[model samples]
Target: MPTTTGMKGGGYYDANSKEQRSASDAFLPWLEEAIAALPEPASHQQSWNFLDIGSSEGANAIYTMNRLVEIVRRQSDLPVWALFDDLPTNDFNQMFLNLFPASTPALSATDVYTAAIGGSAFGRLVPPQSLHLATTFNAIGFYETRPAARLPHFILAMHPNPGAPREGVEVSTSELIPFQKQAHQDLCHFYAARAAELVPGGKLLVQVFGRNETQSTGHGLMDVLNDALLDFVEADMLPRSFYEAFVFPAYYRNIDELMAPIREEPELAAAYRIEHAESRDVPVPFNTAFASTGDRETWSHSYISFLRAFSEPVLTAALPQDLPQENTIEKIYQRMERLLIDHPERYEFHFISIAALLTRL
Candidate 1:
């Protein structure tokens, strides 16, 4: 299976981004502070440009942008131009529709303008020295390309195989190191690109998935899906070839990996200052609600729906074109639903997120 580069479907992401919404809401105070700290534009004529990188469907963007506009209005009457950037395949139409509802006036009758810029966030999406502030939420984990290593066949072998030794059940360093290196390189390029686009005193706030210093590299959902796929292989429901060849582009970095370039590279160090960096465990709300209510069926449906919304497109793209896409996808989700129903406790996994505030110098 060839590696896919960008997130294609918008509806799934929009529907399943509760974790993203929570994370963004948690980071709003920092966003407001960062925006407030930005040096005023040289003159009143200069419009405030706020760029939202990896903005999908504008659900979270709407809330963030509104708060930003409110803050900027208090300081100055200058026009605010909000740029929303994402892959070309993103659901931009839906984003615009949500942002500019017919019943509501745009930006509360303030001079706030919204536009979409479609492209990869890993590359340059705006002009040099154009933005006053930039924000990315639950994005930037996606690398531009997949690592050279093939997807491991026995990804879930560590889950107590009854007779097997636990010592050798881990994903080896050989399988993980290459991807870590790639992720580090991708972030360096991303920072460098943003460094060029931002003004000297501009600020950037980013929130992304992260692991603790001791935690190993891997995504929670990816782990669950790996096990689910392996189960399919065991039951002869999915081809082993497809399972081995599948690769997810998402790569989460530890705090050290995330800040490595800024700390070591002279150019980055000189161009960007790491104002604040912190990690927190972001709980899955559905799981929390489930734990209190003990509703297995509702909890299972909610958790599986979230997973299916985000992973369906990627999994679908990995399959051969000749497959009956709709039926196959439904079957896959059906199996996933059964897995969650059987093991309701699996929904309690908390996503670890790292948020950083950077200033361009």
Candidate 2:
């Protein structure tokens, strides 16, 4: 009955502690823009608290606080406050504490707490009607699927390397994926609860990752990496231990698969009127600016970094059990490098970052 999807290996947010912070920096402007789009409270000049849910490493929280303070200072008001909350496992508390030392007061008052969201079990991280604005950047959606075409490949990816047998690892290709229904349900549930917590007419901005219905570019790259992973696992390139401990749950959902949970919550669905769903072509190197850059190599590297960051679980699960487990980060990096080198023509790396905005009813 845990609230999270119970994904094994590291969840996307858990991978490469360094990368989590980096990604947050990249997301800051988009997030600030999203927040700015929200209908301001009746007392826009009055200080109000903003909540950053699922805040990883609290970078977005810090960045958001900084921006909010700037906006408020223009009017000569007290600085805004921010609360950064995430599941205990996210380990963002210590990371942010280190980044913004306690002795150093923020431009606005800031606090961080451990909390799980989007589940049947709710944590009282923020009181009802207490927050003027709430947001989650790219980490709120933990979804699943049961597609026949993808399941087989996913099952192979789930096969643990030899000698590492656990119940979770004993996944059957014949059985459907676990926790799909519950995870989706929890997401919607959390969305609704978050809506209720917002002050009446308060804004909730969720910058979740999504796919373009019109194009297959994002889905295609995910399929390629996942399919290649399946081949590697089935070929015994990776041991069973690796799959069970790491890969099966990563890259487990296509865009549709992941969003299924969010779209199901009627209350959460009704609480917001979607204002915009925008898709911007984020070139390969993932220009932090994303607007000015057009270099192909930069685009390629950006895509590669994304594949590595977003597909952490998949890579870990496909690792051969026979390999040294803990010291395998560099080894896995080498493996990916070899794959790209081995099949230069087979790889096509391109991606887009999708953004959505919704208003709290």
Candidate 3:
């Protein structure tokens, strides 16, 4: 197993990210308007560039990039150069396989050329003032580096995190300052980097899994994993240190954190003009399917698969070196699947997000 940093690659992420797609779908209208409002290019301009940052398995990335390509086609015959960027640990080969023109016959004669780059989205990757339109979906909540927060026993740093492995080991809001500051810094870098790459009047659509007034993504369901793993530690099946050490290297930003850069940082404030911003809940496909059909087996599998797609790599990296890697990973997820299948109410993954459309100034 590779010590990777992002989503599980080699086709796993491609198949299981329906919830992400649904989130992107909610922004479809914003996408269309943003594309429609593109400023006319100078007479010397040669072609257009469309970039999707943090594009995991290329499925959702391709969906949006293809749409951008299609809409641009209606406006002109300029060839489109599409770029997908993510962490080097991500599965680039799998991304390319799905992005190839042959694999997507509909895009064959569209004069769209696709390429992938591996790097931090918080860092500059392309030439300054070069891109026409750029986007990121269901990303940017990830911490550039996991904060040294003092969550002694939990899967995440969110409020209402599980208290287990040790009674009275609760993390107070004040104790989570490192995580809060880290998120602010990450967002600062993210906007600044993207600002340097986008041209004047370019549209930047950023939609990320985050916190709203009532709901926060990765909260309740993460608690389920916590309780199940705490059981493992109690039974001596896994060490307590694993629970103490494992925390998702992410922070779900509330609206305040989302706008911190704009309010506090001059670089971000002077670089772009915000066109639209929102924070709301989006429907989860598996959850919706269960609500309508009450299919425990199918919904449980889909829910667990979706979880495993993104979390498996990080969870695997947290395992003790002596354990059988594959077997232990399977056991952990298998246990969660059984838990969800038996008590559907135990699993609550609310899909809430903060999205915005900004134009480069």
Q: Pick the candidate with the highest lDDT.
A: 3
| Model 3: residues with Cα > 4 Å off, grouped in runs | 1-4, 101-106, 161-169, 324-326
In order of appearance, the predictions have TM-scores of 0.90, 0.63, 0.93
Put down candidate 1 lDDT per residue, 265-313, tens digits, no spaces: 8899999988888887766778788879998788878877776665676
Q: Per-model C-alpha lDDT, please?
A: 0.73, 0.48, 0.80
Clashing pairs in 1: none
Residue 210 of model 3 has an lDDT of 88
Q: Which tens-of-lDDT digit does each residue in 36-60 have in candidate 3?
A: 8887665565778888999987988
Off by over 4 Å in 1: 1-10, 103-106, 154-170, 213-220, 323-326
Ranking by lDDT: 3, 1, 2
Identify the candidate with maximal TM-score.
Answer: 3
Q: Candidate 2 on 30-119: residue-level lDDT in tens?
A: 545555554455465355667767665554456556675565444444445556665555554443563457756544433322232332
Worst 10 residues of 3 by lDDT: 161-170
